[model samples]
Structures are given as structure tokens and as C-alpha cells.
Target chain A: MTAEYFMVLGLLGVAFFSVAGALLGYEKSISGFGVVVVATVTALGGGTLRDILLDKPIFWIATPEYLYSTYAAIIATIFFVRYLPHVNNYYFLLVDAIGMALFNIMGIEKALISGTGMVIAITMGITTGIFGGLIRDVICREVPSVMRNEPYASACLAGGLVYAALFTIEVDYIWCILGSLFTTVFLRLGSLHWGWHLTIFRKKDFKNQSD
Target chain B: MTAEYFMVLGLLGVAFFSVAGALLGYEKSISGFGVVVVATVTALGGGTLRDILLDKPIFWIATPEYLYSTYAAIIATIFFVRYLPHVNNYYFLLVDAIGMALFNIMGIEKALISGTGMVIAITMGITTGIFGGLIRDVICREVPSVMRNEPYASACLAGGLVYAALFTIEVDYIWCILGSLFTTVFLRLGSLHWGWHLTIFRKKDFKNQSD
Candidate 1:
């Protein structure tokens, strides 16, 4: 759809995923303060980086809507955490996918508007989709999903390429957005269900260093 | 000191603190892959924020020196960690102080150069000094020093004010740098030594409902 519509969707995605992140943090027995920290990071961290890289004044600092939305997410999660034991893991994956798709579209659109080439637009899109989650994992002292075998950044990359292809073909903007979103969702869900993973290591002939 | 000298010192501070952060993360059982993430955030996070807020291209992206220095720092720490176990905590504090002081001075200087008012400059300086560490702590799933009952931000604020005062009085650049550095170090060390803290929590007689 339009860039304005994408921005609105991106904000909503952030608010939703922020709640999901907070719930995950609560499940991990992270402190209340820690939950808030993780929630805000999951929600605002990607968009913040995107704005910074684009040299735009931070969207949240100017609008206050993002901040209030994230705050609401955190409060909602905290109050509902006890009643939501089994929902965290599934919700995490779902909301994360939504956030990744929305951010990918928004970042690519912004880069295109800034007169960047398709390659740079795709790079920025993947960066926007994954950087926040990477930051969140690093803060939570967990290995980021990117560094793992999981197809996290891969999904983003695929979605970004799809978006660029759709744009190049002059497809309707709505169809382009849906195309990218479905690609990311299917890739992520398939990876989760089928245990699909990238092979990052190869058998080494060398002995142990101590030898 | 000349502005060039301060910038170099600040870079060195970033290098040193990044190494120190890596070592601490290792000790905390943070994953090997995550060490690089932590180091990058601890070292470059604040300046990155400052550049973004100023709508300037990120310095490290342009110069490459900052990234190279951080890489070197990580390698150095990984090799030296075992031989320096007892000193890790001390080194962490020392490097943190140096980085904070240099960042505080640099941030204030940059703000002044940009023609910002004294108050905003001071605020930016403190924010620049502390935000990286705040990010680092959050990633490590620890309570940020700022949120704790510590004088972390207060020390930076004090140093920033001293820098502004020196500038107002037309003090020589070298002496102004020294004044700010000394003020920051003394305040930070004194706070740690005597458990000094700023008054942050107003009395809450009612249920704590605010998020």
C-alpha cells in the first residue's frame, strides 16, 4: 500500500511485538524492569536504527505515539502474564514475523524514496527487520536468532528481494506488500516447523588447539 | 587539549572500554558470538546515538577506524582474559570512567560547536556518556547503572556543567578538558566509594501503578 499506510502498520506491529517480547521476558523470569526494557527495545529499537541510518529525527521522539503504544504494551503484558503461560512462545514467533515483515517493507520503501538502489534498499530492509531482535537477544544474554542456524535474517533477505522484484515489475503496491509479507511468514513458519536451518559449519580436519 | 586530541582520546577510550566489556561478558558466560555484539554496543553505541540525533552520518561508518579499533580490542581481550582474572572488575571500572569522561567532553564540545545552548549541551553530553553503558547493561540482562541508585548520570551531568563553565570563562582548551575529566572521575569514584546516589524516587504513599 502507500508509505503512510506502511508506517501505520509498522507502528502497530511494533506495539504488538513489544507485548510479545515482554511476555517472553516474563516467561524467562526476567525482572519487571527488565521486561519493560526488553519490550521497548523490541518495539522501538529497529525503527530507531532505521531513522538514525536515514538521518531522520527519531520517529518516536517526535511523535510520542510510539512510546505510548509501547508503554501500553508493556503494562498489558505485565498484568496479563500470569494468565498467559502457554501463549508466549507461539506469540513470540507470530508477532516477530509480523514486525519483521512490516519493518522490511517500511525500510525498503524509505530507502527507495531516498533514491537508493535496489541492493541498498534490500540491505536496509533486512537490517531494519533483524537489528532490533538482534539487540534484544544480545541484551537478554541469549544468542541472537540471526547467529543461530535458524533462518531469521534469511527470511528477511528473501522478503526484501521479493519486495524489490515486485517494485521492479511495477506491481500494485498492495500486492507487493502482501507478496513480501507472505514470503517472510511462510519462510519463518516453514523453518520453525520443518527445522530448516542454514549449514554454518563444516567438518574441520584440524585437531584441538591444545594438541 | 585540541579538539583533535580529544577525539583521538575518545576513540582510544572506546577501544579500551570495548575490550573491557568483552572480557566482562565472557566472564558472565555470555556466548562467544555475543561478545562482539556487547563490545560494539559498549564502545560505539553512544557516539552512534549522538551522530544520529545530530542528523550526521555515523563517524565509524565514514572513518572505519572505530570499527577496526573495536575488532582489535576484542581480540586483545580474548587473548589476555585468563592472565588478568583478578583485575577484570577494576579494569572495567577504570576503562568505563575514562570512556565516560572522554565521551562527556566530546559530546559537550560537539554540541557547542553546533551552537546549541549550554543546558542542552550539558544534557546531551551526559546522555552521550551514559547511553552506551545503559545499552550494554540492558543487553546483558542487568539493571542499567542509570536505573539503579547510582550517581552514574549525575557524574556525567556534573562534568558536563564544568565543561560548559570552563567554556563560558574562556578557559584554555587543555585546562577545560582537564577540569571536566577530573570532575567526572572524582565524582564517579567518590560515588562508588561512599555509595552516593541521586534522589530519583519521590515518596510514593499509594500503590505503585505507574509504568
Candidate 2:
């Protein structure tokens, strides 16, 4: 039952990720083919990377339905996303947060089930949630917002911790999933609204010392 | 005997790749720790991505010696690369060509070994040859030289086809490796010397055309 639930949410997240990627392409005014390609990569890249790192068969290979879903999302985006006259930040944030949140929870669960430690699970969850977008941003020749100023991975870390804690006590699986999902989504939304940001590291410039 | 030879060359290529990445970090004037991180990622990212896509155990995981090798390369780079005053274009090009050429051959060979088709072998070869540098370029916020020009991926494609054809004809494995490596390295150097470039795809802008 729990596995089925995770599968459904994971699939849904892929659809959201595909649409979000397509939206980025549209915002950048790329070609239609580029849109589809970017969408497909965004939807599958994170989960594929996570699975590969874990030495497991990719989730999409096990169920080709995921590929079909990504295609379907691309088609949907061509009609809807491509026609938008102006960027809709709210819709993008909501969809992106939800999708990444689902992926975060799924990645952590996969790691824990594979007997990985809690810290590793959280790190993997963050990687799954944000790495695809980082790749997308890099491809577009823009600095990744997640890397510079956003609580995106921070939200994933918090939600992953919540999920792991719940699982540790043998709490109900349904609540564990839902609770973590809610935490990430809300955390992201709150950060977006309040302008919360991650502090970045920078090397001290010694040239200034002489002055 | 052939497999073992390829293994040694591929390992040597990884060492070179790691050093080349570290050289890039130094050229960019990043901190020491940041240099090592960037170098490690650039060295391993492509092979890691290839292994994951092929659903094989990551080479570094199977042989932790690769990690130690990366560390050694980092130490070497800190001493050698940091002292270089100007853009050592010759050294960079030579090392990069050798490393990427070897990776191109290995990726194709691994694909063929896994019972994959010819097209996939070529694609994987290109991916393995260029994707690590792609990751490096992205992190450094530069346009990927491969995507833009200089016959980067083109050389890999040519070399991969040569290797595959030679393998198909049951040629001596040593000759196949040397022939392809020479082909890629020469192709890149020729392009560099002659200012050869790849044509990029761009949609015609109607507004610009009218203006």
C-alpha cells in the first residue's frame, strides 16, 4: 500500500517537473523542440541520478508509464505554457515546490530503505529536489536561484528530517508521506513570500588587507 | 588482454581529467578547497552519469583507488597549476584531448559490451567525453566550449565512429585505441589551429528580419 502511494505521488511529481521545465523554456523563448527536450530531462534527471547513485534500476525503466507521462506533460505545456503572455511566478512556484517536495520525500524514502544513514538520506533528498533545476538553469546560461538565494534545498532537508523521524517511530506511513510533503511545500512557500535565503560561502580577499 | 589495456588507459585518462579540472579551477582563481571540489566533480561526473544510465556499479565505488587518484591529482594541481602565470593553452588542450578521447572510446566500448545498439554507443561516447566538462563549464558560469564551437563533440563523434568501425572489423585492439585517440586529438588540434567551428541551431527571428 505504501509503495503504491509513493509511486503515484512520484509519477505526479514527474508531470509537474516536466511542465515546470517546459515553462522555463517558454520563458526563455526557446524552440519547441528544445522545450520538449528540456522538459523530459528535468522530469527524469533527478530520479535517474539518484537511482544510479544507489546502484538500482531507474524507476522509469521499471515502468515506462513515467516516460509516457513526461511526454503527456510536454504536450500539455505546449498548448498552455507556451501561450502565456507574461511570466506567472506564483503558478510556477506552487507547481515547482510541490513537484520537488514529492521528489525529496521519495528520494529520502528510497535511501532509508536501502539502509543508508539519515544524513545521507537527507542529502540525497536535497539532491533529487534541486539538482535537475540546477542543470536546467545552467543550460539556460543563468545562475541557479537555488544556489544563490533560495530556501529550496533547505526545505527539502527539513522535510526529509521530518519524514525520517516519523518513520523512526513507526508512525503511520500515510501521515509520514503527507506530513513531509506539507512541510516542504509550506516551507518553500514561506521562503518565497518572505525572501528567505541560504547564506553562501566566499573566500576572503587578501588584497583588501594591504589597503 | 584488450580489456585490461583499455582499463589502464581509461584510468590514466581519469587522472588527467582530474588534473585538468583542477587546472581550470586554478585558472578561475578559486579557493583551494573549491578547486578540489570542482576538480573531483569534473573528473567523475561524466563516468558516474554514464554508469548510472547504463545501470552499472559506479567505477569509483568498485575501486576506491580512483578517489585516492583524484586526491593525488588535486595535490599535484595545487603545486603545478597554481604557479602557471598565463593561459597554458597547449598543455590544457593536450591533456583535455587525451582524457576526453580515451573516455569517448571507453564509453562506446562499454555500451557495446552491454549489448546496446550502435547509435547508443555513439551517444554514450559523446556524453562521457564531454559531459564532465559540461558540468564544469556550468559551475563556472561559462558557455560550454563544446556546445559553441571548436569541434569538441565533433572530434568525439569522429573518434567513436572510428573505434566502433575498427572493433566491428576485428582489428587489433591496441591499434584501435591508438588510432581513435590520435584521430580525436588531431581533430581537436586541427580545429583549434584552423578556427573550425560547429554551426549552432537558431530560429529565425521575424522581428529582426522585418527590421
Best by lDDT: 2
Cα lDDT listed for each candidate: 0.76, 0.78
In candidate 1, position B76 carries an lDDT of: 81
Q: Report the lDDT tens digits of candidate 2 across residue range A40-123.
A: 678888888888778777777556677778878888877764244444567777888998999998888888888899999989
**Residue clash pairs of candidate 2:** none
Tens-digit lDDT track for model 1 on B1-211? 4657856876786886687678657656554344655677788888878877766677665556666787688768766765444444667777788788888887787777777888888887887899888877866667887887777888888898888788789988887888998999888888888888787566663346653
Collision pairs in model 1: A139-B139, B1-B174
Candidate 2 residue-wise lDDT, B83-186, digit = tens: 66665667777788888988888888787787776766776787788878878887887766553546887788889889878878989988788888999988
- List DockQ for all candidates: 0.08, 0.10
Error of 1 at B154 (Å): 1.7
For candidate 1, the docking band is incorrect
Structural similarity of chain A in candidate 1, as TM-score: 0.91
What is the TM-score of candidate 1? 0.61
